[model samples]
Target chain A: MGEFDLIQRFFLEGQGRLAAGDEVPVGIGDDCAVINPTPGMQWLVSSDMLVEGRHFLSTVAPERLGHKALAVNLSDLAACGATPRAFTLALSLPRADEAFLAGFARGLFALAQAHGIALVGGDTTAGPLNICITVMGEVPRGQALLRSGAQLGDDIYVSGTTLGDARLALELFRGTVRLAGDAFESVRRAMELPQPRVALGQALRGLASSAIDVSDGLCGDLGHILARSGVGARLEADALPRSATLAAQDLALQRLCTLSGGDDYELVFTAPAARRVEVAAAAALAATPVTRIGRIEAEPGLRLFDAQGQVLPLALSSFDHFKS
Target chain B: MGEFDLIQRFFLEGQGRLAAGDEVPVGIGDDCAVINPTPGMQWLVSSDMLVEGRHFLSTVAPERLGHKALAVNLSDLAACGATPRAFTLALSLPRADEAFLAGFARGLFALAQAHGIALVGGDTTAGPLNICITVMGEVPRGQALLRSGAQLGDDIYVSGTTLGDARLALELFRGTVRLAGDAFESVRRAMELPQPRVALGQALRGLASSAIDVSDGLCGDLGHILARSGVGARLEADALPRSATLAAQDLALQRLCTLSGGDDYELVFTAPAARRVEVAAAAALAATPVTRIGRIEAEPGLRLFDAQGQVLPLALSSFDHFKS
Candidate 1:
């Protein structure tokens, strides 16, 4: 099929289509999609590109790939405490595969419908498989959660209690580790289908001093918050969250996984110690668990400590596309 | 270099840096760039993806590729009569080569500077070469041009006289045709460096009823307007604009190239016959040449007329990514 026909058949029908509201006057099928921004709201935009063999495995299901593609972009909005609004997808495929497109669209639209966000515009071309999505969202003017907002003496927290399952799944696929059949399925699911913490992020808007999604591991991502906010941090290594599967591993493996493992899509945020009660209430409102793991400090660099306060040597690395 | 370092080194420093104004308060460093909307305007968004080999040959220079990438997307915004604002780029490259990136960024930023659009946020990764850009612009509320606004008896117009020089260059590259050195360079430039008629599109805003960018050949792109507006058209084949070199070619070759040539980022629009004088004034004000080559019809299908007013057969095919 041709490019336009492919879009019409796979994307334009049965998707999570918002009505012609004041926010969006036009959707797809125009030169440019028109959005009438709401008064007093600022727009939030982010883009992410996923390539075959680098971002996903050759054997990954098309539906899961589709979900992950949009999910990652949504995670960026979640980090900034923005509400999901609309997105554009630019896809390149080896050929026009009907079955693959259908399965992919089903998974993509399913999540879009759940979030009430619409796919407004896109482009399709013939090439190696690649999915690039640009998501646009909204936050109240001057109210977005920013990485530069962190202040000294703030308590650092992470949502969704446990992390590192996705990294463990990657290790399993690489044959560096092994797991039981049921356990393997669980970790694999964590790697393939991550749920963006949109609700928790929005709930923490007025509470959290700073926030960032843990896509590149806690240790590395927290460094971003520190670098941007110009505050150091003291992380309790023993207090870092980990899944049951990860905790079952050796002490060294567990520490490495929890500290440096990436692709969790969990939000790592900070709040003033005085607002602990408010933070807990916000997390409760969103129905997402939160764990306090660190504290912002006036020092110039990150320091890791155990429960007994002994310094732990830093030898961890985060995922860097080019370096890795 | 890592992905983040690559972006910082190439994109962040000295590239069309728009100040943190009321429109764009946050840019690249944040998880999601924030844009505060102008109260009286609405946003126009469009995305385009270019893959190596499919969109451009490997022999082409990186600078031209970068220029073409943004130029195509800007053309879409131009068709909607939107003023340029900001854009996000999602790029995947096989490796982070600093030299290639420097040249590409130079070309990209030069054009971006000319249009006064900032690169707000984006992503980079390791994979086959692919560039996807999402552009956001703005127009007065309810005043942007659209394909669905055309009416019967409207005069069809195209900005920039030449249409098929890009295709001529492609044919020359494939050894299907040949030209003198100077002539070849001119056509090749047309293929590599398409200038989007942004000014003309904005000028035609209230005068033109409908507009579209001629990227997928005049026949096919114009077909979009006809389909969306529920009107037909009669295009004067002999009156179609052509470069001096193209005009010297055989009649059949000229007809095929002009009607079916793609990659010409010119604006094709329709305005009422009564607006001809104003249309000319608009084009003159924008400093771009335009040609009136057709008229919208009440019939349900497009027709082509020769210089003698005889009906011409439809034997041309436009570019389709997959089918081609």
Candidate 2:
């Protein structure tokens, strides 16, 4: 697709519902997307790299890859309680084919517009299929949520179900799933186009003392907050949210999947007990459920407990890029 | 060099002076850098990618590669007349080597701090050596310099010497130049650490009618301005800046070097005749020289002239990533 067509079909439409903005000052058509920052707001910026055969399977659909790339970065902004504003994409393609770019741009702009983000400036280069996206958002100063902000006795909450993608992957690997089938399609869609909790996150700005996006699995990513906040956490396994499909599998396997599976793109956050009601109301308004699964403690460690209150030691920690 | 040591050595030291109240809110130690955007200032965001064996040779020094990656994006901000604030880096490495990363981060942070920019947030992944940086700067609304703003009779100018990298690359390829020698060190430095005229660019906000950063050779990058501004340009070759070393080379080769060489990272901007004196003053204060190389014409085309005042027909255009 030509640049303008690609942008028109994907980006310029359906962007009004994401943020609190009306018209984008400079949208997808310009060399750069310009936005008027709300007064008293500081722009929060983050970038991510997604490479084929590393971040995703080579056979994965191009549209899914595009969606996930932007979704992952948007999750970062959500974790910080920043309202999405604009983003720039730098894409390196092995070859510039009209079909591939069309699909990719469609997937990207779908999510971007859903969040009211405009496509800004980016570089196109020739190389392997690698996408680097830098996203910008605005948050009130001293209010952007941080992992270091979790305090002891805060309630830990996570949005949506965990282990969804891992279960989908298992079914695909076992040859028991077909992407065309209704049940299988739902699973596949969940794995591919997982929505970030942007609205929930923004509403949690002051309520949630700390937050993180669960891209690298729940236990592992939660560990980051605990480490950064100099606190500990106790997660009750019974409180963890898992799909019925996941629960149907072996219990041990399901627990393992819930703890270690990556690519969830869900929001994990912490708030004081007093603000739990507000958080629940906000989640209801966003139409996404919030699950209270654990609590922050002053101790410096993480523990998982069984329904009977027995402590369970994890054989392996969460994902590490270098180690795993 | 372990990851920690490399980051500490290369990224943590020798940051330059900063303007008052311009400290980075969240710096290199966090998952992402946080900067307090000046109230009422719109953030200008841009990202660029530099791939190994594509944008530069494998033999190029790590330090230089680090600098160029950041410099190119800074050039984008400069094009918009934005003052540097903070940046995020996403780097993909074929292998994790402490020395390489140290040198790279060192080169990156040195330039960042020099411009009073903070390293905010980025991702590190495994792949071919690729560096993608997203830089954010602040500019007042409607005051950003854009390539689409050029008008007829606009005097086009370029800052600093051009063609140095191209000449230096040729010498290096021929084994006739060495970086170790003092005479060639300056040339090597020019090629490696191309300075983006950030201050001059910001100062040109009100004066410049249009602007662009010269990353992909003058002719190719200038073509972007022409296309966007709906105007043409007539460049006088004698006005193009050349290094003393390049001046000694074959005149035709020197001309070609300036015409097609990439990675200059200089500001090519247009200003009205009335603002020429102000532009010169801004250039002097920034410690960078400026030369009037061309003028914007009402017609839509590019023309080049030789030192003898003879019109030269361009046999070939500069680099085109898509067409090439």
Candidate 3:
């Protein structure tokens, strides 16, 4: 397909999920997208890079690649308590294949429209598959959450269940998971198209002391919060929320993968004990469950505990961009 | 050096020229960088992708690559009449080499500081050499210029000299241009780091009817403005600005390179006929010369003219991302 035709067919079509506002003065087709600033709100912008064979396998579907690319960036905006407004994509492909660009743009527009975010200006270049998305959102000054704001004694919470996709990864690696069955397909879909909790994050802006998105496993990502906040965390192993998919896996292996395997894309945040009830209720209203997995402490190190309170030493492991 | 040290030694030690009001609240060293928006101004955002062997040669210097990556995006923001503030760099390298990253970061930081922009957040991944930069700037509401805003009878102008870099490219390709001498080195530098006319762009915000940065050669990029504005242009070959470097080359070959060769990164814009004197003065004050090379016409096609006022049929060739 021609570039103009491809853009019109995939991107110009209205997205039914999210509402567009006056601030997005120009969306999609332009040399540069224009956004009218809203009173009392400041724009928060962040960008993330996803490289083929590093972030995902070459065999991964184009649709999932598109979804995950925007999802990961949205997670960053969510961590900052910003409501999505618009984004620009810079995509590099070996070739401009009609089918591949169509599916990719379709997936990106779907997620962007779902969050009321408009696709702005971007560049397409010929190279190895490299997708970089810069997302912009609005947040009230001094109200946007930060990782350095976590206070001692604050409770740590995570949205959705952990270790679900890690278990699915194991099944696929072992050649036991088949995409033909509905259940297997669902599990794989969950692993591939993990949603970023945008609404829930916005709601937590005032309640949460600090926040982060769990792109690199919970342990490694939370450690970043701990280091930045100058606090420690004690996670309750028994309180950890493993999905039913993990419960079906080998117990020991599931526990290990849950702590080390990356690509969860969930938000891990810290809130005061006094606001726990309010935060929980908000998560419930959003239809996303919250798990109180840990608490912040004075010391600057992470520790895990079993049901009986036995100490469980954890390895500092996650997907390190350089090492991995 | 390790990843953390590489970040600290290169990225954290700022070197780029930053324009006023481009301070980054929380820069490198954190999990994510934070930018404090200038109140009362809407942010203008744009991104560009440059790939080795596609956009540049594998032999291009690391520092030049770094400069071009940010400069090109800054040019986009300039086209929109935004004062550049900050930029996020997503670089995919084949490996983690300290020397290369250090020089690259130095070049980028130099430009950032020069333009009063800060190095915000970005991702570093492993892949073929690719650089994508998302730059953010601020412009008052309803003030950002656009290519669609051009009106019939608008006087078209281009900043600085064009085709200089294209002639340099031809010389370099022929292996006749020795880089050992200072003059040849300057020519090579011009090819490597084509300045993005940021100041002229900012000044033209209220003065110009519409503007676009010339990256894909003058004829093609100007065609974008004409097509979008639903107007035509009559460009004078005699009025086209050519550098001494270009004038030294075969005249016909120089014209072809200037008109069709890409990667100029200069701003081409149109203004009301009454504003020409003021625009020329403003361009002089900014130390960037401007030439009225063309005029917007009521008809909807481009026409070129020779010094003798003879009509030269437009060649209509340009760089296309999808075209091989």
Clashes of 2: 2
* Cα lDDT tens digits for candidate 2, B260-284: 5666778888999878889999898
TM-score of chain B of 2: 0.86
TM-score of 2: 0.88
Ten residues in sequence with the least summed lDDT for candidate 1 chain B: B315-324
Q: How would you order the candidates by lDDT, starting with the best?
A: 1, 3, 2
lDDT of 2 at B272: 93
* Model 1 agreement with the true structure over B20-85: per-residue lDDT tens digits: 566688888778999987888998899999988667878778888889889999999999999999
In Å, residue B28's CA in model 3 sits off its true spot by: 4.4
Candidate 2 per-residue lDDT over residues A41-155, each given as its tens digit: 7667788899876677776677887788899889888888888877878777777677777677778878887897777667777777788998878788878888888898999
In each prediction, how many residue pairs overlap at the backbone (N, C-alpha, C within less than 3 A)?
0, 2, 14
- The Cα error of candidate 3 at residue B90, in Å, is 0.8
The per-residue C-alpha lDDT of model 2 at residue A321 equals: 25
- Pairwise DockQ winner, candidates 2 and 3: 3
Report how far off residue A105 is in candidate 2 (Å).
Answer: 1.2
Error of 3 at B247 (Å): 0.9
Candidate 1 Cα deviation (angstroms), residue A207: 1.6
- The best candidate by TM-score is 1
TM-score of 3: 0.91
